[model samples]
Target chain A: MVERTEKRHTEKMKKKQAAHDKIMAGKTAEKGLLIVHTGKGKGKTTAALGMVVRAIGHGKKVGVVQFVKGAMATGEKAVFDAFPGNIEFKPMGEGFTWDTQDRARDIAVARGAWDEVKRMIEDPSYDMVLADELNIVLRYDYLPLEEVLPVLTGRAPMKHVIVTGRNAPEALVAEADLVTEMTLVKHPFREQGVKAQPGIEY
Target chain B: MVERTEKRHTEKMKKKQAAHDKIMAGKTAEKGLLIVHTGKGKGKTTAALGMVVRAIGHGKKVGVVQFVKGAMATGEKAVFDAFPGNIEFKPMGEGFTWDTQDRARDIAVARGAWDEVKRMIEDPSYDMVLADELNIVLRYDYLPLEEVLPVLTGRAPMKHVIVTGRNAPEALVAEADLVTEMTLVKHPFREQGVKAQPGIEY
Candidate 1:
């Protein structure tokens, strides 16, 4: 029994060490500015969600904009809406950039949504703002990097924003307060050829 | 658009004010116990979970004895099994408390399982201990509170425990570091006159 206790405790200590390392990965993230999540990894949004739930538990108000995220239905969206009118979530209806079919309409939606998201960045009302899948928008040039940069830098005096997508731009990452390139460690999908699990993935 | 900005900022300030008030509620809970959970909250388990998660985020190793929880194949139990693994979840299957209806059999499971939970408290390995739904056992008199009190108070040097169930005793409340009474506030089954939703309610 004592040996069982010691083994798991050692594992626990190793995890604590990893968490500490992740914390120290970026110095500017301490003051909170921007988070850039990019790479061929599956969980940029999941990592952002871990942070969102942590902030909410700490009594923070959050605003979220999901570019190319509107399919009009998802279990997560349902759960997000169930949070008694405190948390705010808005999804740009263009859904996936590739799936939208009309490039011009997608760009128009992204541009229009950018105006609202840009304002939220500078407004002190949101404790955290998650611009989900915006990296893809930037990658495809649906929104200019010039327009994105100012909001990233001059965010609401209190608001912190996280940008998640694969293939995020180099300049954006260079400017980000915290940049985490999620490396593909080991994913169940790859091993088993299983599709994304709804609750776990989306 | 300008009005929207002002409104968002105003809401932010109000949320900050509400946050200040909620901060005190956590302090009220700090008589030295924490509970952390990372599973679906279909039943009474979610309330038990929020405390466990809050406790561990503050750096607590928690021990849990899940009497009726181990026998079933639930998504929550799988996730709990995957948690940092420092969380000791011994799922001794006795089925629902009333179903077994045998005092001798019930007492043996309680004795065997609570023995490990008690060991966690005495050895200083646990910061918070949750005997999830042990209150039901207490109500049935399968385990004597006298057998529990010494382990609870003597372990006061390093641990805090949460016992959750439907009909908690008045004496247990007095002994608890924090007691939360989850009154079934407008349950879905009663409201919709439908069966409990799978994974949302047991």
Candidate 2:
């Protein structure tokens, strides 16, 4: 019985490998990607930061601009600070929209953050740029989508850009090369009364 | 007109802040979390690695075991190796299930990996334990869910554990404190003929 099962598994794997190889053979293009992480769940920024870490590991330069989470200190900020040569970490926002309470001020902050993002994209020295929470700013119309879309679309071919937030615009999703929406299944903050702790939330 | 807008914004923000403070005040519980990142999209393992970086930044010890992605050298392995004191990174898998093509071997490898995970969970010096892609093994019945769920649920109260993969068992999800499902919205590999690159996909 075991020998029969082994034979069946080997035959199935042989067929699967052939299929996988054929698909992979056609995937020959290598270039920078526009990755979007969206949805009402968490890990949008966390995943983007993971990419930043990967870029750093590969000895590539990275630029990070936090659009709506710069009001207070965060664990990522402290971690990114350690790699001064590899990353230019900028948390330019005053706070979340509701926390800031001023539309005009929010727009101004977004504009400033967007400028930093543009600088990183246009500069060839940086290999990856993370526009953290840019979607939230776009959702609130703090930064004009018209202005944002063109710059992102026209970025250097070899440069990677990651935009992350909840409620990403339809146009951005359509243009992205890879997009993942994080869906919240169960949250302890709501169901178990657990507070956000360091090294996990931040 | 601008002054009126500013005044209204201030009033709205005041009410929002009061509500936020009240909600935050009630959240006083502090303990370890069983975080599960599962779905068909990308970033499940990436986000878990991000938390590993965060833990390293905070001077906390971390244990990471990659169940099914150790056949080749990955960029993350090279990076995590730099932090010898903070992280114990282990990639125990021979490869993906189809690539291995032997159910008995897969089960044996999974058992070995699970032993490492359990060791980390039982070790008090480790602040966080990441069972990277553990759900895939559970999904395939390579590791018994009955044996897995209890150890995860009965872990030390102060030790955070993160399990990530697609198709998480419902029991694990139910026991988890935080669960995020990564849904594939658009993939470049399917749509744009792009292959996964080192810094982004690894």
Which candidate achieves the best lDDT against the true structure? 2
Q: Mind giving the per-residue lDDT tens digits that candidate 1 earns over B45-102?
A: 5435444444444445677677666563352343334346446666774676444444
Best of the candidates, DockQ:
2
Give the range of the ten consecutive residues with the poorest summed lDDT in model 2 chain B. Answer: B71-80
The CA lDDT at A25 in model 2 is 90
Could you give candidate 2's per-residue lDDT for residues A46-89 as a string of tens digits? 89888888888778899989998774246565566656788998
For candidate 2, lDDT tens digit of each residue in B1-202?
9799779877887898888888888899999999999999999988988888888877789999999977424656656666679888888998888888888898999999999999999999999999999999998888999999999999999999999999999999989999999999999898877988878987
Task: Work out candidate 1's RMSD over C-alphas.
Answer: 21.0
Candidate 1 residues lying further than 4 Å off, grouped into runs, are: A1-30, A188-191, B1-202
Instruction: List candidate 2 stretches off by more than 4 Å.
Output: A71-74, B1-8, B71-74
* lDDT, candidates in the order shown: 0.58, 0.89
What TM-score fits each model?
Answer: 0.46, 0.96
Candidate 1 achieves a global lDDT of 0.58
